[model samples]
Target chain A: AQSVTQLDSQVPVFEEAPVELRCNYSSSVSVYLFWYVQYPNQGLQLLLKYLSGSTLVKGINGFEAEFNKSQTSFHLRKPSVHISDTAEYFCAVSPRAGAGTALIFGKGTTLSVSS
Target chain B: DTGVTQSPTHLIKTRGQQVTLRCSPISGHKSVSWYQQVLGQGPQFIFQYYEKEERGRGNFPDRFSARQFPNYSSELNVNALLLGDSALYLCASGPGNKDTEAFFGQGTRLTVV
Candidate 1:
């Protein structure tokens, strides 16, 4: 079994300000980490993922995340944010490899970027 | 270029009624997974189907059932609906079982009264 924890439920930031969304996971075996964004009344879109290779992963929209093995964390970060970046972000995890491995997601963090 | 797609964007049902939700996966994708997202909460896994077979199931009750068709499209059936069943049901598609990226649909909002 795998579980994800997102520390913040809401984050407010001004336009052009930097932001970070914290995520931690608990799993007995190797897992794949992913960050997803959901706009108002829309489905989740994959922002980034960490499988095997470098710990630091870059994603679309100038966002990035670092996977820390020791800390069990995969925090998403952006150098600067725009009002269009306001959306709900979710952290998810799944087993490394297997058939029917479903993803388990965290509660979610709502990002509100205001000008 | 089409992503995953779901039907009946919104539905309203009474308690004890039955409901069916549909999903169409992306072209060339063979895996379809179902999830439920309640208000103010993240999505919960419900079922996963691949190659017209059941691949995985979540902690949902037996009242929740689903199946995939020959075309790889799927349908989720829920019996004896309860108010607690009111939630946004999402369908995702992937190329295969171990595929890393899964595309998602807008989801079907099922409201049980």
Candidate 2:
């Protein structure tokens, strides 16, 4: 089984300030990692995913995340923030193979960007 | 390309009532998954269907059930709704493979009173 943990419940930052949302996971087997964003009254949009190759993966909206195998972590980061970036971020993991095909998500972190 | 789409953007149902949510997967996608996101919490997996067959299920009870049609559209049914069942119901789709990622829909907001 695979499980994800997002370290923060909420993060508040000013526009143009950098922000990082931490995530960790526990899994006995190799897994695929992903980050998703949910805007008000909208569905979840894919931020990025770490399936293989590069440890650092970039996504839309200038967001990125790094997969650390040893640490079992996949943390999301953005060099600067905007008010439009305010949304909820979720960290998720799914097994690399076999029958466990569902994505396991963390409790999520609410990012609030202020001007 | 059209993305995953769900029906009835918002709905309100009384306690003990039943509700059915719908979803249409993207073109050529063969898998559909259901998730429930409550206020201030992350989404919880409910079920996953691939090629009109049940492939995966989450921790949700029997009250939560889903089915996929030959066209790859799906419906989620919840029986005897409770206040706690009020949440945003999300539908996702992807190619039925081990390495592919799922695409999500706009979601249906279900409020149980």
Candidate 3:
């Protein structure tokens, strides 16, 4: 079984300032990591995913994440944030294979980017 | 192409009432999964269907059920709804059995009163 933990519940930043959302996971087997963004009253949209290869993954809206195997973490970062970036971000994980392997999500981090 | 689509953007039901939510997967996608998201929390898996068969089920009770049609559309039926059942029901679809990124619908907000 795999589980995800998002360290921060909320993060506040000024417009054009950088921000980071921390995420960690525990799994006995290989897993897939994903980041999703949810706007107010909207569904989750996949921001990015890390399957293999490059440890540094870039995503939409100028966001990026680095997968650190030694640290067992996948932290999302944005060089500069905008007010529109204010939303809820979630980190999710799923086992590599087998039956009933659904994505387990973290509690989520609320990003508040203000001007 | 249209993304995953769910019907009845909002619904209200009394306790013990039954409710059915619908979903239409993206074109060419064969997998559909259901999730329940209570306020201020991440979504919890409910069920997953592939090729018209049940592929997986989450920690939900038997009162929660779902099925996929030949066209890859799906329905989630919750029997004897309770106040705790009030949540946003999300539908996601992927192309295959592999862990590909899934597209989600806006979700149906079910309010059990």
Q: Candidate 1 lDDT (Cα, whole model)?
A: 0.95
Clashing pairs in 2: none
- What's the true lDDT of residue A109 in model 1? 100
Give one digit per residue, the lDDT tens place, for model 3 in A1-115.
Answer: 6789999999999999999999999999988899999999999999999999999999999999999999899999999999999999999998777864487899899999988
TM-score of chain B of each: 0.97, 0.96, 0.97
Docking class of 3: medium
Worst 10 residues of 1 chain A by lDDT: A94-103
- Please give the range of 10 consecutive residues that has the lowest summed lDDT in model 3 chain A: A94-103
Candidate number achieving the greatest lDDT relative to the actual structure: 1
Q: Interface RMSD (C-alpha) of each candidate?
A: 1.1, 1.9, 1.6
- Per-residue accuracy of model 1 over B54-84 as CA lDDT, tens digit each: 9999999999999999999999999999999
Give the root-mean-square deviation of each candidate in angstroms: 0.7, 1.2, 0.9
- What is every candidate's C-alpha DockQ against the true complex, given to 2 decimals? 0.79, 0.65, 0.68
> Which pairs clash (backbone N, Cα, C closer than 3 Å) in model 1?
none
Winner on TM-score between 1 and 3 is 1
**Per-residue alpha-carbon lDDT of candidate 3 for residues B4-73, written as tens digits (9 for 90 to 100):** 9999999999999999999999999999999999999999999988888888889999999999999999
Better of 1 and 2 by DockQ: 1
Instruction: State the C-alpha lDDT per candidate.
Output: 0.95, 0.93, 0.93
